[model samples]
Target: MTANPVYEFTEREQHILKLLVDHYIEQGTPVGSRTLSRLPGIDISAASVRNVMGDLEHMGLLKSPHTSSGRVPTSAAFRVFVDKLLDVKPPEKGTIEHIRTLLDPSLNDQALVKIASNYLSNFTRMAGMVTVPRREEKPLQQVEFLPLSDQRVLVILIISDDDVQNRIIHVQRNYSKDELAEFARELNEVYLGRPLAEVRDRMRKDLERTREDMGNSMQRMIDVAGQVFGPDEAEDNEDSMLMAGESNLLGHADLGDVSKLRDLFNAFQQKRDIFHLLERCVSADGVQIFIGRESGYDALGECSVVTAPYEINGKLLGVLGVVGPKRMSYAQVIPVVDVTSKLLSAALNMRN
Candidate 1:
């Protein structure tokens, strides 16, 4: 949710302010009082419009660039406009059908997520992003351990009928092939049908309980099981984020500074910060808008982010959004994001 700035404005002041903002957004340049006075519904002289513009500047809602007598809206002004002034309408039926067609339920999870990101970028002409769904732990079907040279053991995991995973663990001492097989057999007997995370916890507790009287072979087996069932960093990376059309931001005049553009692209490449920002929106309801400097990240000080969370069976999977210049058409982008999330959620539910 965007916080609305508290500022009182008379009917004439509000009318001129809206005119100035609309003109500036369309032209990407400062708007002078004469230009606004000539617009429809002004019913005032250029001099009177200039006086109102000066008052708005004093309120911190507008600023005058040194190069021009015209005034442009400040970030504060955009916040007020988005929260109270702007009227949002539903997306066209054609757009909703296009999005629905692109997000086909028959596609795999990765493909579906990629399509969603592309749709956001193509529709809004901005950088689009989507976080991969967090995987749930599945019950183990079988386990195997094979001894290798140089104190290494290969742990094979059968998570389901068709899912198999392999991991390598280094040990303090080399064990014979027969000993490794026996260790795997013992672990499978106790943990074959349990989820991997729960199995790891149970193994740790069993070790704590039997530590005083356990023999060397049993202790070694427990240690091996711990390594085999631990969190896999490589697997976690698979669930990070997918992005498309980042270069579209390059075409935005407000974001043309070379240093700022480089930093923004770097932030996208190193997704930790952006991922954390999107993660905060996972619990938020409906669409969220973050105008310039409101995103709280230096890289996004000149940009706006619109995001919505997508889910299946009412369980949140992740967030999807677009990053663009602050002057973007929120009336269009907001509905696209809102509808895309719903379509993505419906497609995922169908796939499941």
Candidate 2:
């Protein structure tokens, strides 16, 4: 097989490449040159088709399965197809409304997260993940203490917006329920309705000031809170989270590589890595398409992520996107992810 000489293929190579990828995608198997010759528009002999197949293989666009005399499209070929040949269209209004309905106010955060995860999985035919906003981000509205034992107390933290967190503290000495109430009153008087971060800081400073004068019981309570609300020591509070459709990648022939699946699972366990990958999904603005190696995670090098930022009152807060195998039909997934993200932002803003 001769190299087509033109940097771009002679028209014949273009048609052959498209047919190969499309057939492979539909059948989940390598496509042979004989099948290529049988498709209309390319008036070429089986031998000639084989020649072009060889040329595409040389171009690193196709790979041969050791067991078969056929070729499968590589990530490079998928990238080229998305960039030049994929025909994507916007999602239908009804579909968008359905998505909005699923995210309706009637559902609580946990329910919504689950439903959204299912929706992404079904719609994209891939694994879906959704991370609910952490409760700590909400302000602390109230506090109460319940005595569990002489030295154990259950401290309940409430946020004004119907969010709650509970922590258990151990004291060197026991305090009666009345004493717990009195302590709760004092704490609330000092810090209720403040952001958790602020409340935490003030409590820490107050504890530091009173440490020497305080009795062991009160000091132990303060110590527990200091640990609970202390400056985050985990590098950073990961505000952004992921909900992914991991199952969606399973049936694809391209993902047959065991190493690829292993790496992908490892990447999934590292939320920071996924966050970093999605971070690139929102750049200077507009919908971003990151194909294969462009996603920056080598494990995801065989996948593509199309994401757009979601906002509240024009302020960008986070991004929502889809992660699919590189062979994903970008034309379909892009619009679905893009419009869904906008809907999410709109719904969020309405609550404020």
Candidate 3:
């Protein structure tokens, strides 16, 4: 973990390091000097390759797990590989179609976020997550009130793109059907298509003005509408989101240590911290790579997260990514995240 960013690596060192890392990633094994010598363009003998690996180990970029075995790149080495030595490849045609097919435009945002999570997991063979967008920032689309028992009622909220959600609450008294309809009409009249927070603010102003001039019953009804839409404060942009493929992580041998796996599952179960991390990526210009300990979470020390923020116009909607072992194929997963973000963004923008 040399922090100053080693820019002094020579051409030979870079070539050998890239060859070893690529081999280790593809084969999922420690790379010996013998393996390096077999690389297509490499003309060096095993002895020469050993010298390079020993130099890399001394620099703390690689590690020897045993006395005479192969060398494994350290997290520092991975940082160098991803940041400098690696060459990314275009996503395969099937990868693009997987994204397009799963994230269908006909689906709602919620459904597609779930799909994105699953697709990332299935494609990358790791855990995947997409933070739910804060959609309440827009004007409320429609409102309705339905009655069940004498004292119970359902309040429905329709936001952008006809996304409908409902909640039930109990009231002190019962109202007739006509009375309920009148209340619904009044609520729609005042707050229809207005931002929920703005509606709350405007209601406060109107309430103060009408409190003195209107009957107590009308004032009470307005208070009820305020209670209906005011609970969430109009912020749907949440760190809370959907995740699929957590079980997939359990299958990775790198996470086979029962205790660390348990801890990783616990971290995923309590998503607030991970969401905070995802929220940080929303401001990054492109894909953000967190390699192992760089994530600042111990449970994720053996993992890597590739996250990209998706947006509508310039407004960031949410972040999506694949979570896998530190040996994940960056060339493959990067484009998956990058393209999925764009697709998710385009999907959201279509609602406008």
Candidate 4:
């Protein structure tokens, strides 16, 4: 639909709709009139509530599942509730401190990956996941060459934002470690702190113009560098991919259907899809929420994502986000995700 339809509701209808959505989200079961009447100040007969619920179902706001005699909110009902009724609260101060304190300062990248995933898992009480940040937009921070064989050199790249990338380039002829060191120094002086997108093309033009007369090894080194470090132009194949937390969304009661859950998981598995999603996330600074079917991913049509972009010194570097059932506690998760993204940026910027 192009726009959410405005449903004209009486005070009772509004109260009943909110109650049904809240109860369903909490219990993951159809809500019956009797259960709703027990709420404070309801002051309504079971028959009256049932009549209003039937009207809601007819208006496409609720559904009665086959296995139960109660009603549950449909995607449309949830969308309406999210748009008009949700009262999101920030995570409590104690909870925020617990999350902050749980992050150990001593972990290396790999260790941090595991620790982060576990930490998020515990905090969300859902699957805690994180994806490694994309390295393509990064600027060159440092480069080193390690000699492994007569002709093989490992090109280590330390990029902006503490991201490290390495590639092995084989020289056609062996050079002394002195030559490698000289080349590394030269490369650093010319390209250090330059954006990666500018790095290769500038070098290629320079090398092609000046080094055409050079030996085959020098030419091949230039060629290999171009091949290995190219920037991604497509939405899919960009720099980011999921690093952890694939299993968390499956536990949401709303995603109990295997087919829908599989589709959601499959979307995360596609590196390009996740990268595009993160790219979109980083395009904005604050928490961005994409509800079910709101995100562009077809597989994610049944889920919602809450993401925040983190930065270093005003430059956008990466994103941290969570995907869960559409019934996610946006009030609680948004601030927590926001704090985590800031922590990540601060930590990375400190390292830099």
Candidate 5:
């Protein structure tokens, strides 16, 4: 399924290839020259059509499956179709409004992400996915420290009215309630309203410069702060993506192989590989499409992944997209993904 380099096609070659690919996509079967010859816009005899199809097969754009005399467009053909031939169909105005209504701005970010995933699946009849927004981007609203027994402290981080995170960190020694309160007060004064990522970096620098000069109590407080403010390993280990309609892929004929479906479902359940794939698209601008074998995962070798990064105020948050057979309607699916990303971004922006 590795891609072949693009080859120059004559006007007749492009026309015949487009007709064959379109028919195969619609019918989900090999296309014969006889069928292609009769298709609209193809004013060629069956013999002439077969000759052109032979040329296409020689160029690695089409292949004849052993079970059938007809031909199927190879991945290379799809690549050329999307890149040079496909005319993308934009969603209608009503479709835009419908997506907007579904992605209501009043809903919280998590709820919005779920709705987006579900909508993509429902609309495309394919597996849909959205990455959970990064936790460190939220602005800090407040911080609190409560002393616990055996040299441990409960650190509470308030990110917003609705978002709060709790972490328990072990300290070198226990401190009085008043000392803990003082430490919280000083940290809040310096780091309040900053993003958690920024606060973590600044805290690291502060600890480095002040460690030798500060008293033991202050040094201990800084040590506890370092532990508390560092990246959450637990959160990192948890799945950062939300997926919907993975079972929908079961209905796609091309992906019906039991072993292939099993591996695909397992990849969905494990999520690490897919999440990393989406992460690569985070830095890409606008929509990114990965055809068969382009995704670099064996389970996805028969699938096409269409993704677009969603953001707020021009800052990227995460990626969202659909996964389906390579024969998917790129003309429709492309705009659907593009518009979903925009609507999701708008909904999140309303929250901020």
Candidate 6:
């Protein structure tokens, strides 16, 4: 199928492509020439339809899995259909009201993400996922330091509302309680209400310019801060990907391969590869679709992902998506993801 370049499609070819893609997504079955001949608005004979289908197959847009089975649109067909022919259906009023009712203004952002994921699963009958917003370092409200035995100090960073991060730092020499308390006070005063990434950078430069008499103490503080606020510390936290309805993947015929299904679900349980896929969608605006093999994971080669990046006040918070078979209806899923992202942003803005 990959050997030949795709030829420019004629009007009849476009009609066949649209009908095959539409019917295939609905039935998960291949389309026969007889079916195309009888389709409304397609005034063509079965012989004509067969010839066109053959040309499309030669163009690498359609394939015949078996001699008896009819032709089916390939992933290439889907890309062209979505990019050129597919029409998005606006979300129903009932679904909009349902989303509005569920996305209460008072609910926290995390709660809203879960709600969105659940709604996507229920509506699409597919595994739903949402990723929490990631920051290199959170905005600090306060910081505390406590000394421990064996030249170690415990550092507590209070970030966001009610969120705390803990780190342990080793020191070169012993320090009294007074020095620890003074350092804590200095840190809080210097970097309060700012992201730790900026704090770390500012402190690093300031440490280099401190008075010679106070150099040793400042250098020790810098070392401790370095340990607690390393660039990669954020990656060590618990996984931020939230998922629901992974069980729904079992219901799709495209995932009928039990081993592949197991691998897909296991990917969900691990949450790393799933995030890696969704992470690519974060920079993309609006709803995005990844068809079979486009996800770059063999476990997902038979599956499709429809995702969109959601924001709060124009800031990209994270990504949300539906995972189903490659035979998914993009016309339907696109609007759901689009509307959910809007509702989620509105809900978060209300909370803020």
The candidate maximizing lDDT is 5
Per-residue lDDT tens digits for candidate 2, residues 90-209, read 898899889998777555544554576577778988766544444434457788888887678888877635456677877656778887887778777877766666776677676667
Q: Residues 1-352, candidate 1, lDDT per residue (tens digit)?
A: 3455699999888888888877887899999989998999889999999999999999999998899989999988888788877889999999999999999998877788899999899989999998876443456789999998899999898864445778789887898989989998998898887766678678767767667688888988877777776543444433578889999998989899999999899988887777878888988999988888777788988889999999877778789999998888888899899999999999988876
Which stretches of candidate 4 lie above 4 Å from their native place?
1-12, 41-55, 104-114, 145-153, 160-164, 170-182, 198-228, 231-253, 261-275
Candidate with the greatest TM-score versus the true structure = 5
Pairs that collide, model 5:
none
For candidate 3, write residues 3-66 as lDDT tens digits: 5366578788899999998888887789999888988979989999899889988899998776
Q: What would the per-residue lDDT of candidate 6 be over residues 1-352, giving only the tens digit for each residue?
A: 0232355889989988999889888888779999888888888899999999999998889998775569888878888888788988898999898998998978776788899999999889998899875554356789888999899998888875535778888877667788888888878888897876788778667656646646676777776766666543545213588888988878888789879988888788888888888888888978888877788887787888999988766767789999998888788898988999888888977765
The local distance difference test score of each candidate is 0.85, 0.70, 0.80, 0.70, 0.88, 0.81
Worst 10 residues of 5 by lDDT: 230-239
- lDDT of the structure predicted as candidate 1: 0.85
Q: How far does residue 178 in candidate 6 sit from its true spot (Å)? A: 3.7
Better of 1 and 6 by TM-score: 6
TM for candidate 5 is: 0.94
Estimate the TM-score of every prediction: 0.82, 0.67, 0.80, 0.76, 0.94, 0.89
**Cα distance off (Å), candidate 3, residue 233:** 6.4
Q: Which is better, 1 or 5, measured by lDDT?
A: 5
Which stretches of candidate 6 lie above 4 Å from their native place? 1-7, 201-214, 234-238
Cα misplacement distance, residue 6 of candidate 5 (Å): 3.1
Select the stronger candidate by TM-score from 5 and 6: 5
lDDT for residue 64 in candidate 3, whole number 0-100: 78
Name the lDDT value of residue 266 in candidate 5: 90
Model 3 lDDT on a 0 to 1 scale:
0.80
Residue 32's lDDT within candidate 3 is: 91
